[model samples]
Target: MVDTALFTIRDERLSLILTRRKDPPFEGLLALPGGFVHAQEDADAEAAVRRVIRGKIGFDAPYLEQLYTFSGAARDPRGWSVSVVYYALVPWPLLEKNTSVELCPADELPALPFDHHQIVAKAVERLRGKATYSSLPAFLLPGEFTMNDLHRIYQQTIGARLDKASFRHKILEQDIIEEIPSRFRTGAHRPAQLYRLSSKTLTAFERKI
Candidate 1:
């Protein structure tokens, strides 16, 4: 089995997708998007997961990373089962575009089937653990946004408010984001400049950002 813990931001809140299962073993209950491996059609594990997510959600996430492996004799009712889990960061706009799925608050997920509750908890842990020192939260935003916008999402991801000056200083010092040539308008206020991730991958610093 392959399951994807896909997360997105809405109204400055971090949330993950959960679909109601219509099949046996947990019909009518909420669960993560997943399915069995298509060994004959998929070339590899990553491809299998990509297929599972796309088939289930009708959208592809930008950042897909392996979370962990879950296997046990009784984890699933169908004999001994193994599930390869992946965690992803999806752009909020894309999530908005896809209306078939439901976004559950990452911290307040309801009861889930099998080991899905554990899977979501781990995915949240991974996101929050790397949020402070990396550019992981940027994937939750659009291609262009303001420093204040970035700060708000980061605070939502980490569940802690950050000082404006301190947050701006850390982001600029690391140089992970580049300011755009254009500015965004806020009603009755000065136009704020937009920024986006400066590179393809996030770089780790000697000290946490």
Candidate 2:
């Protein structure tokens, strides 16, 4: 089985982790980070996906979800194969500090081996679509932030501008975040209220998906 991993980087750019293939079928070309599931070592598809990610990228994602599965005889050169795909989100700040792996922009990628490009495109689409009603975009931000910070992340993820007042109203009504009482000091202005995800689990903010 095959597996893929995605992470968001600075400036709200979504990137996919890719490594050069050194084996047969397609050698010396960049492709999604993946490996065959070792039946003996893995208890399930999810476990194998996690193992592939940890071994390749060396970091556990704050949020990880199964994107889709692709299967067919022609998909792989070595007989028939099935691929379980997953997309993960990590704060941009965390991505900048990690240097273990290379991240390629999902939308502006080079020629990829096999059907990896298709997998990246599908993952990107799902992330943007779900950002509208879910808390998925919060994974791109820091733990403590102001309303403006949260709003900007959402707007960037969805690729649309939102009215400041309206967006604030919706966020407050949803009760997805809670105020920290303490304020974040900004230069030459009153302190801004700090906010964070009310629930510790990233996906627990909303269950719309």
Candidate 3:
């Protein structure tokens, strides 16, 4: 079996996606979106995850990464089951207008069915650790955003306050984003220049930010 822990930023908080089970074992209980791997159709664990997410959520995740494998005689009631786990990061805009799954703040999760709570914790830990030195949190924002938007997402994901000047300097020095020429978010104060990711792929920084 394969399971996915989908994450996104909502209302300035890091959030996770959950669905209620409809069948037995844990009927009506909240669980991460997942499904069994099809022997013939799925070429690998990642392929199974993509197929499951597409079928269950009706959209493709922007960023997905393999997390860990969990297996034990008692992890599942069905017995001797092993689960290949994956975590996906989706931009809030991508889910805002498309998905109807329940969104829960990652820090205040209730009891989950199976060992899903452990899976979630592991996923969050990985994301936060990576955010310290990579452009991982940028995947939580829309394609185009201002520096302030980027800053807020990073703070939320990292769960820490950053000095604005230092944060901006670090981000600019990393060269992960490129300013959209002549584009600015105009408001009462000076317009903020808009920028976008240099590439859709994730970039790792040589030094921690």
Candidate 4:
């Protein structure tokens, strides 16, 4: 199974979690955390991904989904091999800085060894597309955040500016989120209500899809 864990972007940079192979055939080259699926394990793709992440990256992913399968003679140097690619989404704060399993910013990602660049491009496209009609981007935010926080994430994921009033209206109308009783006071501006994801709304959206 091929696992693609997308590190959260912070300070206007996208990060990816990669591991240096300790064995031959692409040894020492940074690649997405993954490995071969064991024959004895569960047949579920998500479970296989969790197993791969635990074995290769030493962490259980918070978010994961099947991306696609790659099966081509030229894709792998090991003769004939079929890879099941999975996408992992990680929040920014969950990542450690300057460490082995740490984040590698998009701007500084060195030349990747295999078809990783293509995999990443596809993952990004999926992320953006999902962000438009789903609450996938909410996974990137902290436990408590402002409307501005939600808006910024939407803007970043979709790469566009959203109308503030319409954004707020649609979000509230859909009942996807609820304001927390507590308010955060930042600077001299009026206190803004902190909001959290609504479980009911999430369930509704999932059923719709």
lDDT of each: 0.84, 0.77, 0.92, 0.70
Tens digits of per-residue lDDT, candidate 2, 1-209, equal 75766666555666666777888878988887788789999998878878887777677777888999999888888778889888877776766655656677767888988888788888888888888887788877778988988888888777778899988887887788898875674767777888888875644334332
Tens digits of per-residue lDDT for model 4, 1-209: 55565557577555677888788778888877777666687577677778877765566656677788877777678777677888776666656443566567654676676677777778777777777887777767767778988888777766667898888877777678888876674767878888988861222343221
User: If scored against the real structure, what TM-score would every candidate get?
Assistant: 0.94, 0.87, 0.96, 0.83
lDDT per residue as tens, model 3, 61-95: 88999999999988889788899999999887777
lDDT of 4 at 173: 73
Off by over 4 Å in 3: none
Worst lDDT 10-window in candidate 1: 200-209
Those runs of model 2 whose alpha carbons end farther than 4 Å from true positions after fitting are 183-185, 202-209
For candidate 3, give the lDDT: 0.92
lDDT of 1 by residue, 1-209 (tens): 79889888876678888788989998998889888888799887789989978876676677788999999987888788888899988877876666678888887888889989889889889888888788888888878888988899889988888898989998899888997776664767888888878986756655655
With candidate 2 superimposed using the best TM-score fit, by how many Å does residue 124's alpha carbon deviate from the native? 1.3
Error of 2 at 184 (Å): 1.7
- Model 4, residue pairs in steric clash: none
